[model samples]
Target: MKIYFKTFIAIIFGVSLLGCDPAEKQNKNEEFPILGRKQFVERTVNGETVVDTIDHTIPDFRLVNQDSIWVTPKSFENKVYVADFFFTSCPTICPTMKKEMLRVYNAYKNNNSVAIISHTIDPKHDTVALLKDFAQRLDVEAPKWNFVTGNKEEIYELGQKGYMVTAMEDENEEGGYIHSGAFILVDKEKHVRGVYDGTNSNDVDRLIKDIDRLLATYNEPKTKS
Candidate 1:
């Protein structure tokens, strides 16, 4: 499953440059594709056996944010959000990632339809107090940008199986851990719609534009078949 997920991610990165701007290659009315592995379930429909498709989604999670509020999937109900994994003390790419993320935070800080969540991979070192101070230094607050920490194993599981991103401790790597620099874009339904390199300005720009595109999807009027 990990191999399949990685291959899909490789494909996304491979063609990202060509399709970064949906308006350039796709109809403006077209919705962003739901990313991640999907499954085919057999079910009975009108007394006939039919196969149903179920797209991958971010599973339920419970983590405490900097403000001491219990953050859960319910916190993002009826909204689209950007999610990423990082620790406050990361020495290598985290600084750049957060710098780029600020662009995203400033873009949608006031937009209630969007939100951002950052998970700390180094939970032991990144305590709630540290995360709070970290958010203060960044000049960001919750409900707009949430810096959260929780059980180390649960966080890792969410990062890997739920968000389909890499997040784990690696002593050999700089900062004492290794995690993906990709920012995941999840829709109201919890399905991942896009992923961007959080350390790259150009990619972050694409992410900002994609957020607008994704929000527009919600405003689109429903049509009858």
Candidate 2:
């Protein structure tokens, strides 16, 4: 009877160990979709030649930030960033999006590796001075969070072709321009790792969780020096 009981306890212990495995837990993180180009020819692996799938990345852009500084893709080099479109005068979904973005800002306020880039769809009205005032009103500091504005056509092209979001003018729309209420998650390599609805609390919660996961990918296990 003692031998049989000991074997049963041992089996239970093994099962519990398996259930608590960290690798298993980590594997449960939902993999965020990569938006943009599917693949590209990297280089010839050998004389035999090889092609590699391309991870679509946010294209290079130059726009003036709240501080009246020219912000470019290089500004976010080796950093993960959240991106969205909003104008200072927006009266509809932009307010909700900004509220949700504040949640993201609070989460990574002190983390230098994280940043947020908000572009203005109505660049004509959202000039650098106007953006600066808007950022101040929102209690956001420059460099960490940038409210950028530039050529309307360029910004629109970036919204559609670069970030895969909508940004266009419409007379019937409440805000005058129609833009997506999405908060885009970009990795250190400029790749769009995830897209969350900026107006939904639940989606923003997932965005926060996924940001941690995305950061984990960069925190590779260090080797003993």
Candidate lDDT (C-alpha), each:
0.93, 0.89
CA RMSD, predictions in order: 11.3, 5.4
Give one digit per residue, the lDDT tens place, for model 1 in 1-225: 999999999999978865777656566656678999999999998999999999998999999999999999999999999999999989889999999999999998789989999999999999999999999999999979999999999999999999999999989998889899999999999999999999899999999999998888788888743
Which regions of candidate 2 fall more than 4 Å away from where they truly are? 1-29, 42-47, 222-225
Kindly state the number of residue pairs that clash in model 1: 0
Inter-residue clash pairs, candidate 2: 39-54, 40-54
Residue-wise lDDT of candidate 2 within 7-102, one digit each (tens)?
999999998998889767777865567877787775775567777888887888999998989999999987899999988889888899999999
TM-score per prediction, in order, is 0.87, 0.84
Residue 72 accuracy (lDDT) in model 2: 96
Which candidate number would show the highest lDDT if scored against the true structure?
1
- lDDT of the structure predicted as candidate 1: 0.93
Q: Whole-model lDDT for model 2 versus the true structure?
A: 0.89
